[model samples]
Target: MKLNLTTGIIPSLNVSAGLLGFFFVKTWTKFLEKTGWLKQPFTRQENTVIQTCVVASSGIAFSGGFGSYLFGMSSVVANQETNFTDALNVKNPQPAWMIGFLFVVSFIGLFSVVPLRKIMIIDFRLTYPSGTATAHLINSFHTPEGAKVAKKQVKTLGKFFSFSFLWGFFQWFFTAGNNCGFTAFPTFGLQAFNKSFYFDFSATFVGVGMICPHIINVSVLVGSILSWGIMWPLIGNKAGVWYSASLPSSSLSGLQGYKVFISIAMILGDGLYNFVKVLSRTIISLSQEIRIKRKDVLPVADQNLPASPLPSYDDERRTKLFLKDQIPIWFALGGYVTIAILAIIIVPLFFPPLKWYYILVIYIVAPVLAFCNAYGCGLTDWSLASTYGTLAIFTIGAWAGASNGGVLAGLAACGVMMNIVSTASDLSQDFKTGYLTLASPRSMFVSQVIGTAMGCLISPCVFWIFYKAFPDLGLPGSQYPAPYATVFRSMAMLGVEGFSSLPSHCLQFCYGFFFASILINAIRDSVGKKWAQYFPLPMAMAIPFYIGSYFGIDMCVGSLILFVWQKLNRAKADAFGPAVASGLICGDGIWTLPSSVLALAKVNPPICMKFLDSATNARVDAFLLGS
Candidate 1:
């Protein structure tokens, strides 16, 4: 929870809890073995079970969106909006309801993807990079030669982890107030800083850059340059012409509206394109598979004129066990239907404005969306659960209307959609890991269920502590700003209020960007993969439009580091890059635990590190001398 919240606030630093959990469990298990506490050697399969459980449980933190959807319902957003209403105002989250809401929505995703495991993992052969990486990490730990490499990797991880933690501690002392530390450093210049172009000194984002593909990192940087450097400046010049000059800079009626809506437009355009493309491919693939199967079953006079070429030894063994415990199709369907009914009945009882039919409609369409998300994750290792959630937010929020608590309804629907879509993808990723590890499919599924059950209870409890301890938990400029909360809330507002709320020319800009995104994606696809890799992804570019480019700077720094390391020693960089990156990420992420405690204790940092222009500094000095 601490690590996720820390990373989630920044762009492109959302490290997987499972990846971090792997390090902790591996270290602990090694300690136990060394101390002679274990009766038998800790097998790779057992390690996999632990990893699956961790991923499942920690996933709750990501999906729960305490910092995003839940926070969007809070007073922070209400305070920010000019035309707030009672319907838009939600009470503080209660633990009981939070737990219940998560439980209802989380498991539906698990069952939703069960029937498609073979199709996704076996037939499609999509490269789930994160899952495949994890499987390799686990596999390496249990081998004699690999064990030696693992030890060196662990040592590298520890060294960097210590350094990253201490660095965070050093940085914390200067952050006594808002924008008062290295995070707010004006690395470029005062003008650039005003445009939100600066190095935040965030280790987590740097680590994320190391882990993420080069295209994603570069795309973010390009997006920042386009929006902040050229587009926003051009738009800002139209202040008095395009919007009211007297309006505060933050007003959505002015520049803020353009930022949020334009970003949303690009995101939607990119997501829609990919969703159509992936769905079309999936249908074609499935049709071909059916035809092949039908042909095989038809008249083959020779029982097997020539048997199909045998699979490789490891592949054959893994497939045998994977197929050994087939979760019945009926079971998957029955479980999904049962959960859907429960959610439809129970959710309206808690959130009446959402209506029963709304839930029914969402549930009906959710499975298809879940498959799209899962399949997309397999291909790109990027889960667009939030994009799907945004779709729900607009569709449902608009349907419910502003007079009928549309904001809350939209957020609630988002939770349901996000959890199902997210978990479906996560479970599929774990299935891929299981397939590679040669772990039993039944064990993987059961472990995920157990972990999810644990998460339902644990995630809300963890979030509750943050909610109570931090007085300004979701407020802008606070430690945990929960940036996406504002974005989601703005989306709900736009959905309900319609284009009448947008500033002059905002709608036109949105339209241009929307079509531009689609066109860019079309061109990228039309070009061969060799050239397409260089194209900036619309989705990746859209993120920094709303969130600022500071994190992009951090990520590029990470990319630079990795590039240099690879140049110096490609083999070692390939071997130890993730471990080093994980160290930096985990170390800084874990610091959130103590930082939260300090906030609870009301311990202020000793110094306020801030920068000022020469004129301001001279004035301060003159005033001090006079006094």
Candidate 2:
């Protein structure tokens, strides 16, 4: 209870409890079905467990997932400032407007999306595939004798839970440090050989194989080649003198300015490229839809025009209901409009006299971006959607009060939001498959959403705690020299600078152009089978080279293992993947939830002393063995 309250784990705890409680409800439902208690045609819908799980999961997942990315972006923003300083120092761990927005919006989204289940699931058949997976597990116990089998499965899951708990603790205490990097100990100069390095001797590879698509996995590899193999070495060596002066003595002294510059350039470039592609695609798509509708209307007109006995096209079909086609657009538009209206009102509240044009621009670009995201998710090109959205926001910002901090912050917020939407859409796609396989849509939806929310709430708090705990990293406060804040502050400094193009705006536009060229080319090529997928490739390039490299290798290894296992024993390997994924998720809880607890407890255990000692011993042992 103490840990639960302190860590904000209560909500998630409630979620888990709720899930378990629903199991009993499911059991009863099954019993009712077996006994013909409810004589409905459809499988006597078991709502309690699945719906509860979906709502809980979506909220948690969106929150946590959004939080993690928010932290990542904020870190980048903060580091932007730290990079320029001779000896950087970050301020108090203040939450940004974006963070607050995410917190409030995520909860609302959680609730909002629930009402959508009926629309998305029952009416439109949106295929809640994850629910199908859960249902399979539940229905496995159904028979003439009631839910005796389900109770046994629950017991089995409980056993797994116990092991999962122990595993989480061990990793938390022994290996994980700062929840930042992988591995437990340093192996050599500026390098470490930990879980960060190995995929636990192929276990991670197997897991990676299950999740990562072939295109993305390949893109990641390509990105690693560009970033780590080409760019990092080339840029670092070419500008060695600047690096020598600017960088700290320790490689990890802190995030260096040069590194930040390069990263900013890459993401900016990639995002711009994606935006143009998306905009063009959206325009074309909307045009086509309009054309199709027009075609129908015009044909009807042609027939009705003259007092002709025969129709013009000879097909006697009138347009029925294109209702299905409208559903996706409506949902996408509704989400965008709501967020845009809120943003418009909120921004004005913070700084009054907001132009209606500002709101209109946001509303316009937002749904276009959302459509791109939803469509991209369908194609499994998450990279394309995110970059496109980022670019769209950047372009819109440039048109709007481009120089303002609010605009830049809004840009960042939009970037983060678009990324989550892409992820959610991707999950939705996965659930589509799961649903086809008879998986439980409700359960899957709940699980994922809950995971996202948990991520959001926990990430900010964890960020704050870590920022406070390690002041040396120049964390906690605005790291980017508060660039957005500076942008805002400059408003007062320059009386004439209102609503005009700033120097930063020029840079943003230039970068956007450069990106647009590359993105357009890539999209053009990717249309046919002769070309390599370029959007995700650039995205893969944009992420940290090391992380991308690891992911690539992990995916490759996992793919290999899956191939071998499936060839030898199909059913076992299939089951194994889910089990491992579940384990990792359960295992992750060890560190994720506990940090919040420890911070709240105020257990000032000298983490540095303990970390250094353990790391040192591990290194010495490795060295001795090597010698």
Candidate 3:
């Protein structure tokens, strides 16, 4: 009810309030439609939903990924009693120069992808699923005769949103108080199964099952089975040499640690292999087609805010020479050169430089890594930035130092590359969104650049708010797991303090996982995709290992709902299935707003955070559900 600035509580409160307010407006609009108060087939309310979703999406983009590690210091110099503000420099929301450097780097990422635009979007025509879904939702709102369909959709979406919001209360509030309602059934019996094999039950995850292609779902199931059903039981039986029972496992929980290690390796391995496979095949395939296949669920907007006056290429030769409406070569070249000089050559001059060439290497590697991430997204719709960033850690391994300067540089390089990858992937997906809905790609480009500038400033504030609210981050049973920071920290420790201090088997398993992922992907690609459809996607398989079985179970069941419905009536399935799934996603997705508030209030997360604690019989804590 009250505001707290020092605690970073205001930003999350604002977000939660906005989503609640939007839900109310949506409900009122539907009531108006029913009474005929809104005439002309809902002409007055057009563009309302799309605009709201866009804003929500932008806020989410601002919060996505481990953007915190950009400034979070894992190598803290303070005691347990030291206040968090004192420990992490307690400076401004973020370093100002870092903000400037991010802006230049983000802009450079946009510019660097110009050549890739021609090759991936124009020539190969990859269909990014989420982008297509967004395009479809937008098109539904704007097209002629789309108003009626979209109006109906709005009402349906609102009902589900309200339904899911209440449901989220059961999941979070009640669960925190140790009454998770029906969803807690999975944890009732079977200690091994509950702790190791439980699947989350929620409309949102079920919605995911309904929406994702069956092939992807099947792969997810395979991955889940391999880890929880097989690997988990194996670990319980053996307590194997590769998994030390005594090793620190707070950030990366128990058997879950091995799961995280192997899974990450597999994801990176498979993703890396897929990148090469996609890149090579696209080259061969491009020669066969002049233009690639592309989508629209426009179920078309000519709108892109912050519109730039892109040069209209009237020359036939110019059109033939490059993709239509491409950003001018001079602008690309000019932007790249200017940003590179500042980011690569000038920025690092401030601090005492050790291996000044590291920045240069990052300058060279970033764009290439960005392109690889974009390509992977086009092919898989999964961000490979984490994988690439992990790769960067190893790539820079031998050169990292014991001094603070070297670790800082490594984290900087990771941040720069990740920021670029995240930016580029978002751009590529938006480009796909534009292509499907008949929107102007160049105009979308202008809108994205504007958004990037805003994100450069806003993301830090969102991150810091979470930091201030949750003081003991990365501690066991705490909400902010911050696995990526842990990864970066481990890499630094290994480099600075040496490997003898780390769990030996953990490292070995990680490498084995890395290689196994690569090998499985190679075999799958070689066998032909038709056959590969039956095999699990290594990335899909690996993700579930770390994410817990509960989510995997919910997602699998959601997929089955869609699969069975399609089999029953394929045509009608198209008309209603997506709407239902959309409702579930909308409901549960924004529900995080209130959840964040509860979290900041120390409203207590469901027993799940402390599930391991009670399950392990550690001294009972007050936070544990039903404790």
Candidate 4:
């Protein structure tokens, strides 16, 4: 629920919630061992299976996009648009249909990448950082010496978890009304707070900061400063000049237009740059590999030696097991075709705007794109699934045209494309983990399938809870504003309506940022790593342009804490930092369940801890005294 809400609001900060699940599993297994409840010791390979399953299941939450593509279809977004017609509005899918849609579409991607696992993991040697890290973590837990470190890490996790949960509970008491509590605290005075510059005391983001690289957090902070601190205020001064003065603040023709479009511009710019870069790298690398393989002869010394040096015993053993139970190429191909056919037939029953032909076309082209996404994820540990999804929105939405419910068609298409591309990359990453841990390929595949099935049911139910509990969800200024929903919806609208939909000067700003983002990427690449490492990511910066800097501030605080900890003791910080951060995130996240229940029950916080300036306080005091 926490991940869904946070990632919905800011898709870029999607952390792996599976790590938290892995922690619980590790702890539980330890407890079971102590109690002599287990017949066999929990092996590292088994731990890998649990991690794979947990990741695959939790991953469904992200692919579902309750906060982005799914939410974009809601009335909340339709109402936000000035020119949105009733004919174009799409009702949110019912929970049952959502489950069905997710179930049917989810597995297609799993099969799509099954054929490439060996090539990606062995031949390309893609890092797949998350998977490799999880493998290492599992290995550590099963070792004697590492057990001592694990105990300390678990203890630290527990301490922080308790504190984080208590902090959330404390904050809840003061959040009786809008702009109430420490969340709305004006750490930098009222003006900066109003600009969304103050920290919201979000433990989730703080934990996220610790987990994410420093560049991401810094990029967000930089983006916030550029947008809220500078660009927004400057744009506001031209409200009547650039657009109608009579327009509401929320109107797309006014300040909101600038915010949405410019952010989109930057996002697209960064995405395009990275996409091209990765594609070029993949093509070049593949060609080089082919060329090398095609060589018919070797030097005399090399020819006399074995074709390849013998792998270490561990590597050879792992390779043997990985290849022992290979999933047949025919099965993968057949399963993909079968699922594609089912999706083409079934999905339209729920979302009629997306024509069967569109699904067919996307499926036909998706495998190649999925491969690209998976390969890119291997090289960079960054999946551009959303980028590919955005491409679908523009291409399909434009093809559909506005008169034919293009908005709904585009969003639906995005769901299909995103799920396929995202799951492909994710599965590949898991394969890498399996390779490292010597887990059987067949077992990993089965776990992923089972996990995916579970996610199909669980993600929608979880989202349904949020949808039912929070009446104001997806609305601007609400807790889960689902920032990407608006951005994506707007992209579809732009595709259908073209530049005419943009407010005056908005297109110009977009053009400027679009090129600026490309330029920034180019410079980041050209510069040496020493300087490039310090550069802010255009994609990261673009997020805060819409959502505000509260989360960014929280992340920076997390980074600060980590920095201090590292300075004190680098080894301990490096070893236990993720555990502590995960604890903080998990504790705060678990609190969401109770909070939602309270909200649904119509129970409000006991106090509205609002802040007031001196004059207002004096006026209130005088009035009370006289009365």
How do the residues 416-490 of candidate 3 rate in per-residue lDDT, one tens digit apiece?
Answer: 566667667767877765665555556667766766767666655555555565564544223344434444544
lDDT of 4 by residue, 1-627 (tens): 565555443322112343444456677877998898976766766777777787788788888878788878887777787665465647665898889889888999999999998889877677888778777876776788776777777778888889899999989999988889988999999888889889788888888889878888899999999999999999888867888888876677788889889999999999999999999988898887776666535444445434656689988787788888799999999999999999999998888778899999999999999999999888888899989999999999888888888888898899999999999998998898889988888899999999899989888887887888888777767787778888888988888889998888889999999999999999999998999988899998998898888889999899889999999999989988887887788789878878888898999999999888899899999999999
**Winner on lDDT (1 vs 2):** 1
Pick by TM-score: which candidate is best? 4
Candidate 1: which pairs clash? none
Model 4: CA > 4 A from native: 3-37, 296-309, 622-627
Reference-based TM-score of each model = 0.92, 0.58, 0.70, 0.95
Candidate 1: segments with Cα more than 4 A from true spot: 1-37, 88-91, 123-127, 301-308, 328-331, 379-382, 465-479
* Alpha-carbon RMSD to native, per candidate: 3.0, 10.1, 9.8, 2.4
Residue 108 alpha-carbon offset, candidate 3, angstroms: 1.7
Residue 39 in model 1: shift from native, Å? 3.7
Model 1 collision count: 0
Model 3 lDDT at residue 391: 55
In candidate 3, what residue range of length 10 has the lowest lDDT sum? 1-10
Model 3, runs deviating above 4 Å? 1-64, 67-101, 115-145, 176-190, 230-248, 251-257, 282-326, 345-356, 368-383, 402-408, 432-438, 470-512, 527-530, 598-627
Local error of candidate 4 at residue 39 (angstroms): 2.9
Stronger candidate by lDDT (2 vs 4): 4
Question: What is the per-residue lDDT of model 1 for residues 1-627, given as tens digits with 9 covering 90 to 100?
Answer: 654443363222212343344456667777998898966765666768778887788778878877678777877566665865474446458899889988888999999999999989887778888888878877877788777777777778888889889999999999987789999999998889988899989888888888877888899899999998899999889889999878875578888778778987898899878777777766776677687677678765456556756679998888888999799999999999999999999988778778999999999999999998898788778788888898999999999988888888998899899999999998998899889988888889999999999989988987877887777766644566666777777878888878888899889988999999999999999998999998999988987787678888898899899999999999999888887887888798777678778878889999999988899999999999999
Score residue 404 of candidate 1 by CA lDDT: 88
